[model samples]
Target: MTDTATTAASAVADATNLVPSTKAVRLPGAGKLLLAQIRYQVRLLISSGRAIAVGAGLPVILLVASKGKDTRPDVAGYAVFGLTITAWSTYGVRLVAAREDGVLKRWRATPLPRWCYFLGRILATALVAVLAGAVTVAAALVFYGSHFGDGPDTQLTVTAALAIVAVLLVGAFAWAATATALTSAIPTVEAAFPTLIFIYFPVIIVSGVLFTNLSEPHWLSTLATYLPAQPLIDAVTHAVRHTSGAPFLPVRDVIVLACWAAGGLLGAIVLFRWEPHRSTQRRAARIQQ
Candidate 1:
């Protein structure tokens, strides 16, 4: 009986040895994950042909075709326009599409933190916007002889240059954050372009983005001055059109933009969703039950 028990024990041990042992797979740290996500998002944004064409190509073409003797304001306006296209329209559309396609849903299931994913996307959009805006500015300077200032008396100092760079950086992130928050309103990828265009074109026209609206009603012009685009354009215009040693920061415009950014960040935190619209609706229904 003892020999039989020993043989049974040996058989059990052999069976255990035949089975493969499981290894503990170590997950990457959050910092590494965030860096990887940011790099991936940057590559995705840079490869988007539509974003490039609309945000960079069209503006550069307009700059080339412009016949104005003073192209400084035009350069600034177009640079802002490029930024809006990249940071707002393109970014918003991509977010909505990702949610609709379940990409965001899948990402939410991963061990990766939600904020890291969003921050990566926002940073990538801002970087792309800056690149597109810079291309527009450079094209104007190289092709149109557009200077930062209106005349020789106006010059770009180191401080003023830094201010301009800061404005671009801030505006890019602001627009991107605003776009992310606004994506909650978009139900489908198909609706993104129409919705964004309806919001964008009218604002640009009223805000004097494409041209200086001199003949417009006084009230309309005043209203436009308060919109987001106008403030950005105004800030850029001030930076480019002012004399040497002039204040580059437009305090009122900066305040308005800051309000928008704060509102956008708040909205994104409150309303952002990871699931597709249909799934979200079903979840809501279940909760109501």
Candidate 2:
């Protein structure tokens, strides 16, 4: 080789040799990494104007407006709705978009475990759900004079408060798990957004929370009974009622939610990918059309 080429090759080799093959940098604690991920997810969730309106603002309005005999049930329903907005729209959109855009792919290259990332998303959304529920309850106390029907008894308040928290946390996790699975399996954001809309409206409006009675045609009631939304609504509704000293029936609701949570999470774990899927290619083809 010429002297110039030999000199250039030597310089490159020296640079390559200067790079450390291994460093003793300590990996972060699991807790810290998880917290960082949660912080990112929560920040992303609140950034969206639509998410703020649907997930936070609407519930506040509903709580204030829903003054009457059925106030407790209405409050529970809207609380679930708010939680749904966080999980289904807020988190789902971010996850799918990030995956398609290679952001998740880059995350996979880091030292952060994928499960921690998933856990952070779940934790953040669930936290939001609990906060929304708490806010709704506080609003009721302030605006409606705490007419939750259990009176000022300390025991009743304690029991109801604990139950509400438990119920909201469970429902939030379940909803977020299901959302994760849906977004993971769906190919494109363009397709998933519309699918979410079609599913969200009918299920929320006609099924359980909004219209607790589906017995108009009998089959409607049976259909509602079998659907995922009803049971979740029932669980939330019963929690509110039970806490307020009303009778509770949560066996079916809990069962349904558990089933959805298990199935959805399993699907998400199996289907999730770090890179964009064929959905992108399909979008490209559509654009060319």
Candidate 3:
């Protein structure tokens, strides 16, 4: 009986040794994860025909319509318009829709860090916005015969180029953050479009995006001076005109943009939500109705 028991124990030990041991599952590094997320977000943007059409194509068409126009104020305004749409459509409406659709909630349950996801979204938006701005500017230069400076003889200095690039990047990120932050106020995906348009159209009008804001009332122009779009347009105008020197940087505009960027980021952090405000039943009932 003792020999039989010993043999059984030996057989069990041999069987255990023959089985494969499980190895620990390793996750991708944070940097890799962030890069992957950014790529995915950019793909999502590119795949959306409406996003490309409204964000990129519209501004180019507007620029083409105003052929032979000056580069400084006119092209600058159109370029900024492209940036605004890029940021708003990419982050604002998209995020609100994602949250209402439970995509954000599902993301929350994933192994990906929340910060990584948000950062990736912001970066992707900024990148696309900057590209849109660049395309508008390039189109102006190529087809419109517009030069960077006030005159054809005025060559673009390294410093001025740097300033323009810096402003484009900063402005893109600022607008993106502002758009995403505004998503907090948007309760439903259905309300996102008209609500954003209602708010944005007025600001752009006052900011002189459509026509020159110069013709507007003093109070309206002053209010727009403190707003986001005007500053961006002002900065771009200055840079495009190659008005370089100590005061080349539009200090007031930059400050206002920086303030808006800071405020928007803070608001986003404070008001962010992972789940939909409306319940599933309510959404279904609304759908049925």
Best of the candidates, lDDT: 1
Candidate 3 residue 218 Cα shift, in angstroms, is 1.6
For candidate 2, lDDT tens digit of each residue in 82-185? 77766676667777888888888888889998888887888788877667667666666666564453333312255666766776777677777888887877
Candidate 2 or 3, higher TM-score? 3
Report the candidate with higher lDDT, 1 versus 3: 1
Model 3 lDDT tens row, 211-250: 7845678888889988888999889877656543556568
TM-score of each predicted structure versus truth: 0.81, 0.76, 0.81
lDDT of 3: 0.78
| Cα-lDDT of candidate 2 | 0.70
Clash count of each predicted structure: 0, 0, 0
**What lDDT does candidate 1 reach at residue 109?**
95
lDDT (C-alpha) at residue 244 in model 1? 48
- Which model scores highest in TM-score? 1
Worst 10 residues of 3 by lDDT: 148-157
Clashes of 1: 0
Model 2 weakest lDDT span, ten residues long: 147-156
In model 3, residue pairs whose N, Cα or C atoms come closer than 3 Å (at least 3 residues apart or on different chains), thus clashing, are none
